[model samples]
Target: MSTITHRLPQKRHLVTELPGPKSVALAERRQAAVPAGLGSGVPVYAVDGDGGVLVDVDGNSLIDLGSGIAVTTVGASNAAVADAVAAQAHHLIHTCFLVTPYEGYVAVAEKLNELTPGDHEKRTALFNSGAEAVENAVKVARVATGRDAVVAFDHAYHGRTNLTMALTAKSVPYKHNFGPFAPEVYRMPMSYPYRDPLGDDGVAAARRAITAIGTQIGADGVAAVIVEPIQGEGGFVVPAPGFLPTLAQWCRANGIVFVADEVQSGFCRTGDWFACEHEGVVPDIVTTAKGIAGGMPLAGVTGRAELMDAVHPGGLGGTYSGNPVACAAALAAIDQMETLDLCARARAIGEIATSSLTATAALLAADGREVIGDIRGRGGMIAVELVRPGTSEPAPDLAKAVAAGALARGLVILTCGTYGNVIRLLPPLVIDDALLREGLAILGEVLAESA
Candidate 1:
């Protein structure tokens, strides 16, 4: 395999204590200026990033495993993306696709329609964020199907918008005090292979969800069933093998639009273009963000042409929807993905991560420190669920400790899940294998130390 290095060198170098003096000083200003609600995972402030390393103001070069929540799949400082964005800025930054109708916007839409699963006449609309894409997808589904209710699964995270907040499963930070959310939204059981009470029978799990939807909200009343093939934020939960296909099939039979929120798992973050592709489950609408524009704020909802056209022209648009510069970045990022064959790279990254994490779990088990309850995911979008030793109970404390430990050692990592017990690893797809392994080694060592 060829090594794809970014602008920054592929190595970890910590100059001082984490949140060194400069970072600490900046923190004081941030507390006074930035709102408390805007929380950061790591305290340090990044001045530059490239390849798999984020160089902070403190001069600490931390190995990036989070990828800015899986955004920079082409690397944070990708040359192609930078060049395109710069050129676009020099030409025209924002013409507003809704008004001026730029070619860059149309180009991105065409790409999304062509790239997303299924060739059955797809249409795409670009947005500023995942939440907007999801909201628009729901709108299209409701208008197309003429149904009022939408179904979202357990542990699913759509976004922070008011409508998406209602669709989200967790409450604490995302939905707390954000009451009176959009109504007519219903929740159903997810096929959580590790934690499901019904075990890992994919078809049976699908049946359970279908039955719940029927009892709670009839099929005729439901417009869409939105799901994340690999649940993000709720934990990197990969459902049993056949769970997604069955649910999608049922949605089709019921005339409900199946929307796959691939915000975190789309692009080459997963081995496939989208996680739904792994199960051969083609969603009526697929929401994409994060990795779409190589750090530029861009998201897209690609769906069936008929459904997309069902909505009136002015019904779906935002002032900044499909910004020209972001579109240019996206086009360049897509080019990089194709030229480098990032899909194959993602699969290789997954293989390495799964093997390394599995070995770490086994070692911990042999030592009677079974904190790693599960290690699951596809491609670079992998996570390790921490639990109490020899038991299924969540070990959130251990998970936090592991993340902190890794961060302190100049290895950037992120933790997520409803229970806050999952440590998710999302290194850049173009990251060098040696650096990737180095970060994983640090994570494994941290886990061992915690045990």
Candidate 2:
């Protein structure tokens, strides 16, 4: 086993239960003051974090399997990230990249161009969040191609904004009441082999989607086809091996831009700099946010120079775009990723998670119960879907139980997927193996008991 030092000094220690009196009190206050809607996916209240451990308000130390929804890849409270942020804050925080451009911003963009999967001359625009990046990708595509229609896949989870929501597939939470969305945004079937259309190869599924675009919006009128190489919230659905390449080829032939939303899978979370590399697919545009800055709020769209330059000088920037602090943190984060070999660590984490979850799944099957229907993912970004016996029906109840059970035993896990039946793990790549194994052992225990 290998050992790594945590970045932050340990302070608050677990004294009470998972959510002690302090956390309960804070929750009550939050409920009274904050809106009913904006709490959190996981019930735990974070006070601080270091390495792969989250320190809760109640003083409970939890082994974090969810890296702040995959936003902190280097580690929570990374030393390089903190030092860079502090140094930049003392000098300058924000001048608005549009008003007074900064060197850090340009440096970060250069790093992105060098790192993201592409050999062509590329450019980048920084933003504040994943949703903003996705929205800007559409804008750039439209400006460069002079088209209005944007195509996305079924079971896709782009973002929560009007345009991105329309591009998103699920209705219950993301799109149910958010109607009258942006126009000309179309949805097509994604290549989900677990629940793929009958007699359809993944390539065929992509072609079917392209055919729908031709019939509905006409290829001449389409601006871009956006996809997640591995569907994040829709489930950790890894499309067939050739699916993305085939789609990219079609887009090239049609002169339609291909955008890869690597927001959740980028920054070494999936054992690679970007998920599209797994398929050798080079997207015309790539959007990345989570994990890019070691938890700082930063997102970017990197693409061909001509398409990016198509936007007018004042057309693509915001008041806070390319914030200096975020840019500095991002530079440090990228350095950490490289120096620590976090990509390889991500692959090791995935192997450990898959082995543990698959073993638990087998035990459940022997007992005539099904706790995990599938354990699938790449690198450190892994997921386990809970299902009812002999059926593919989503088992959200079981998922909730397992998560709560893990929490009670001092492990922090997160659940996602359209049905909320999938348990996704995005632990920091710098986590200690002993701690990682401890968390996985707890998860196995929870699954066995739940079954």
Number of the top lDDT candidate: 1
Q: Extract clashing residue pairs from model 2.
A: none
Query: RMSD in angstroms, all models?
Result: 0.9, 1.8
lDDT of 1: 0.93
Q: In angstroms, how far off is 194's CA in candidate 1?
A: 0.5
Per-residue lDDT tens digits of candidate 2, residues 140-197? 9999999999999988999999999998988977888779999998888888877776
Flag regions of model 2 displaced more than 4 Å: 1-3, 7-14, 198-200
Task: Report the alpha-carbon TM-score of model 2 versus the true structure.
Answer: 0.97
Candidate 2, 279: how far from true, in Å?
Answer: 1.0
Candidate 2 global CA lDDT score = 0.88
